[model samples]
Target chain A: DQQVKQNSPSLSVQEGRISILNCDYTNSMFDYFLWYKKYPAEGPTFLISISSIKDKNEDGRFTVFLNKSAKHLSLHIVPSQPGDSAVYFCAASEANAGNMLTFGGGTRLMVKP
Target chain B: AAGVIQSPRHLIKEKRETATLKCYPIPRHDTVYWYQQGPGQDPQFLISFYEKMQSDKGSIPDRFSAQQFSDYHSELNMSSLELGDSALYFCASSFGLQKGSSEKLFFGSGTQLSVL
Candidate 1:
């Protein structure tokens, strides 16, 4: 069963525009959520993360918003750049767990310059 | 700085053959993890090792096994490989066993295995 799901398979946006990727989860035990960006032939790199206690976390141009009641979260990139084009994955882990992250099917983001 | 490094970037094997993939965690990191990514799907966790001990095992079959050396390097071994085993395998590492902050995993490029 897919506990974490990213419904959008792909997204396209113009450079300098805002880009939003959404994710949903069914498990309530997951207390931490993170976003990762991966390029072709490369490993995924950590982008940002949020704890269950907080609703939003921002780092530079990337922001993650979480809604516990709805069991949803989103990653937003402002003024998207061409370099932002990559596959974005949403992952979650439960508190006290051994940091094993369950990931969602990635969303491919393409930024057109 | 060098992140997680996985060897044998690509591999090809026939059914029933054996393949071993290697990974070296970042210096000073102690935990290592293995994940398999299939086409059009998210990465699925395979197993995890910490301090040379197997801490968790995911929904993988017995044909798959892993070991961590004293130097924190890890090896994933697959015996009697099947066509369904063909996928990209990633090795990740974290500083500690903590859940949120100290446990951000850094992944290697991955090993692409094609079983014919």
Candidate 2:
């Protein structure tokens, strides 16, 4: 059973425009959420993360918003750049889960320059 | 800055053959994790170790075994490999075992194992 799900398979955006990727989760035990960006042949790179206590966390141009009531989370990249094109995987882990993350299927984002 | 290290970036083996993959965690990091990503699929957790002990388990197959050495290095041994076992195996490391901001992982490039 998939506890975390990324509904969108792919997304396209123009350079300098905003890109939003959505994700949903069914496991209430998850207390921490993270977003990772991966290239074609490389491993997933850590982008940003948010704790269950907070609704939003921002780092540079990347922002993650969480809605615990809805079991949903979103990652927003402002003024998307060409380097932002990649597959984004949303992951979650609970306090007693021993820091192991459960990942979503991932969303491929393409930024057109 | 040093990151997680995975050896044998690529490997090829025939069915029923065995393969061993290695990983070296970052300095001072006590936790290690293993994940597998198939073609066009997201990463799936396999197993994890903390301080040379198996701390968590995931979807790892029964034919596979893993261990973390005292030096903080890890090895994954796959026996009687099948065609479906071909995938990118990634190793990640973290500083802390419990919650509170040390759980973030830094991953290696990964080992792409192809079974013929």
Q: Report the number of the highest-lDDT candidate.
A: 1
TM-score of each: 0.98, 0.96
Error of 1 at A60 (Å): 1.1
Query: Tens-digit lDDT track for model 2 on A1-113?
Result: 88999999999999999999999999999999999999987888889999999999999999999999999999999989999999999999877887788999999999999
Model 1 RMSD in Å is 0.9
Docking class of 2: medium
User: Model 2: C-alpha RMSD to truth?
Assistant: 1.2
Q: Please estimate how well model 2 matches the true structure, expressed as its whole-model Cα lDDT.
A: 0.93
Per TM-score, the best of the predicted structures is 1
**Residue A61, candidate 1: C-alpha displacement in angstroms:** 0.7
Off by over 4 Å in 1: none
iRMS of each prediction: 1.6, 1.8
